[model samples]
Target: MKVKPLKDNILVKMIENEETSPNGIILTGAARGESNLAEVIETPEIFGEDQEILLRGETVMVTPHCGTEVKVDGETYRMVSYHDILAVFEK
Candidate 1:
């Protein structure tokens, strides 16, 4: 990826929604309805000094329509506001 998100913006790659669980439960993308869990690709250039709420390569639940979708080298990515990030998950 050659693009950088400025200020408090974060660049992320969408993670595929689970299709099935180990317990034989079927999980569909529609189950999420209006949110997407994505992996952060790049952290914002500015972190206000020692802020650690977000980091590169972290999986986080983000608002579905918070940012603009960008295409880079045939891959799709979203640049979202740092405040729009709802939750972080262990990779």
Candidate 2:
């Protein structure tokens, strides 16, 4: 399924964080707290030269409690504004 965000809105999927303790104990994101990190699923097209381009599959950090949650085909997604995005991770 394809989903396109409107205007400066971006579609993202939450990325879960997993950590392993020194004793080999695994800890999930839920065990600690909800993660603010997300992967860009769909980015709004830029029509102006001043707008920055965000590519799909890029990991991004968003502001806490920002964006609207959405569900598509049993999959969860978040629609966040461009201003709410903090940083993008480089490969």
Candidate 3:
């Protein structure tokens, strides 16, 4: 099932990074640290007739450990407020 955020909320998928150890072992994001980086999956379509500042597919930096967790089709997503979005990465 597909999920859409309401109001100023945004749906995002966390971007995980993997690190290679000196012994050739791999470390996941969880081992290193929780990533604040996420990719925009969906944003509220309308907000007072003004276009949303954030667009889908844009990478964003959000406040750590914020937002509600959601699960859809076996994938995890975060529903965060627009205010929680610190910055957006330009393509």
TM-score of each: 0.74, 0.83, 0.82
Q: 50 in model 1: Cα distance from truth in Å? A: 8.3
Q: Cα deviation in Å at residue 46, candidate 3?
A: 1.1
Residue-level lDDT of model 1, residues 1-91, one tens digit each, is 5887888788898887667677878877676354488999988666776456577888899876778889999999888888888899975
Residues 19-71, model 3: lDDT tens digits: 86677888875676888999999987676555356888999999999999999
Which of candidates 2 and 3 is the stronger one according to lDDT? 2
RMSD of 3: 2.7
The order by descending lDDT is 2, 3, 1
Candidate number achieving the greatest TM-score relative to the actual structure: 2
The segments of candidate 1 whose C-alpha lies over 4 angstroms from its true place after superposition are 20-35, 49-53
Residue 64 of model 3: what lDDT?
Answer: 91
Query: What does the lDDT come to for candidate 2?
Result: 0.87
Clashing pairs in 1: none
Measured by TM-score, how close is model 3 to the native structure? 0.82
Model 3 misplaced stretches (Cα beyond 4 Å): 21-25, 28-30, 48-52
RMSD to true structure for each model, in Å: 2.9, 2.2, 2.7
What is the clash tally of candidate 3?
A: 0
Q: Which ten residues in a row have the lowest lDDT in candidate 2?
A: 44-53
